[model samples]
Target: MSAPPLSLRWRRRDEPLPAVAVAASGAVVTQLGADALMRVTAGAHLRACVGREQSWLVVLGDEADLPWADGAVYLGWDGGLLVPTLAQPWPCADLLREPLRRLTKQQTGLIALLPELVLAGPLPREPLDPARLAPS
Candidate 1:
């Protein structure tokens, strides 16, 4: 059978989210709903997203457009970077490379059964990977 679709939670657009603020301070986690809700917006719009923005939404298209974001790190069930790595250069992971792009890179469980990560922070110092640990 095919894998289940990934679960994504997002905040309402009318109200701005505190993602950037938290990023500026630090990134943390939790399992419970009330626990993780802070990752996204408090209230405005929330739902399961087949796709979510890692950062903010510029809304280039309809609401159907993967919760379009101006910024945020999106990860599919398999953990591929959602938005576009077309021209962005990641510090360690050459997003252009096949292996890096295909694998579930840094999409870890922090909040939202899965959370869209957005930040204008510094690129990682080295490749943040744990490939050897995967079962082949």
Candidate 2:
């Protein structure tokens, strides 16, 4: 079967830009145990799985492309960062049932899912720049 078409959405043109630290890397590490996120510089594979109200991040050496499909929504992207759009009302239980996966390079990493509560913090802050985030 064919895969669903990937759709992307950018932040409003008037919104402020995101921080450089969070928007400068493609490969990011999810410190699930620590309740924090870290950006990595090496890795060939990217995997994101959801369960209960939490999302899991996995990296491997196998090369792959960004896993995108229907129903998936991306928040923003800068010259270096990409954010995932999660469902509403804090923890998105819906994503836990249907997870997403992608094979991407370190320069093209993945930001699987971000809960609403997390969004209130300082992680993702702007829409992605399609021109800069697109594969070159």
Candidate 3:
């Protein structure tokens, strides 16, 4: 009964970012940490640490422009990790209700989120098999 692995795409500033699969509501939470889920509240940008040194930042605000297609979520690089910038405003209460998906790309690593910030336990020993999770 463990949470599914989170798929991540590491892109440089010049590369074309992956498109995030979002619903009409324009809100989606990608599992991008080892044991933590980063929720992008309507106007809030939170960074969740993954594993030991790596971290994923979820940015959502009125100024961000997130491109949306029929069934894909796109992310942009902020000189570091992949970031999905949501242009629309999503209520925190509603974001909490949305089901978190294993955000995956063609060939990338996987991660997830934990509830507590102090709980920095080691990631699962097993390496993620991208074949198991759905592609983003």
Across 1-136, the per-residue lDDT of candidate 1 in tens digits comes to: 9766534334323432222111111121112112223222332232221122222211111122323222333332212223222222232123323443234243331222123343222222332222211122
Off by over 4 Å in 1: 1-27, 31-42, 47-88, 91-97, 105-136
50-133, model 2: which lDDT tens digit per residue? 222333222211122233223333333332233432222222323322223222322223333333212211222232222222
lDDT of each: 0.25, 0.27, 0.27
Q: What is the TM-score of each candidate against the true structure?
A: 0.20, 0.22, 0.18
Q: Find the number of clashing residue pairs for candidate 1.
A: 11
Better of 1 and 3 by lDDT: 3
The residue ranges of model 3 lying beyond 4 angstroms of the native Cα positions read 1-71, 75-84, 93-126, 133-136
Best by TM-score: 2
